[model samples]
Target: MKRKYSPYTLPPWLRKVRGACAQFIIPICVFQGIRTILFPFTLDVLLLTLLILLAVALHLNVI
Candidate 1:
């Protein structure tokens, strides 16, 4: 009694794009945070803030 479709089926292209973003978006954000934080003593305040923000995004699976 299965119908022809349900929410589980997404078109292939759309699904692929989401999969790709899920692969590297979080790491890139973290890398940028580290580069800013570690390279310059002047940006310590901004760096810590951005890093924490990225961490929260990572934990929440939103980034």
Candidate 2:
């Protein structure tokens, strides 16, 4: 018989970091998106947040 691993499991430390990034950064990105939609001023913040989101997503294999 062969053992199998569940793909949902992650290392404890990594899980914490990934959870935090998702919880914190995702909301911020959403708000930034709204800000850009409402008032088209200073897109730098929106761009930065999107970049961060992309980086975090790549790191977590969410994309």
Candidate 3:
């Protein structure tokens, strides 16, 4: 029986990557979501939205 640190759920090596991702993801996602809604519509905005969706995939642990 043992307790583990949150980032230690992964293999010894991946803990760093996972921890880094968790640190930046939520704030970045929120910024993208807001930027998409506030600005004029354009292809660049569309690409940004798509990129934000990619962030959601990472946020959900699919990446």
Candidate 4:
């Protein structure tokens, strides 16, 4: 069976890094989204989709 995930088991420094990433993810996603809207390039769209998925995963604490 797969083990349950626990942030508490992570190293202190890693936890801090995760916290920092969680804080910045939203604004980054927003900028990527606006950029995608303006450019609509294949790469930009793919990046935006990845960013959105990452943001959702972070918000849901699934990462």
The candidate that achieves the highest lDDT relative to the unseen native structure: 4
TM-score, per-candidate, Cα-based: 0.42, 0.45, 0.47, 0.92
Mind giving the per-residue lDDT tens digits that candidate 1 earns over 1-63? 865633237688966765665566677667766776677565665766776676666455554
- Supply the global lDDT for candidate 3: 0.69
Clashing pairs for predicted structure model 4, backbone only: none
Off by over 4 Å in 4: none
Poorest stretch of ten by lDDT in candidate 1? 2-11
- Most TM-score-accurate candidate: 4
Clashing pairs in 3: none
Residue by residue across 1-63, what tens digits does model 4's lDDT show? 999888889999998988898899899989998998888999999998998898888778888
Worst 10 residues of 4 by lDDT: 54-63
Q: Scored by Cα lDDT, where does model 2 land?
A: 0.67
Local distance difference test values of all predictions, in order: 0.63, 0.67, 0.69, 0.89
TM-score of candidate 1 on Cα atoms, chains taken together: 0.42
Top-down lDDT ranking? 4, 3, 2, 1
User: Poorest 10 consecutive residues of model 3 by lDDT?
Assistant: 1-10
Q: Model 2 compared with the native: what TM-score?
A: 0.45
Lowest-sum lDDT 10-residue window in model 2: 2-11
C-alpha RMSD of candidate 4 = 0.8
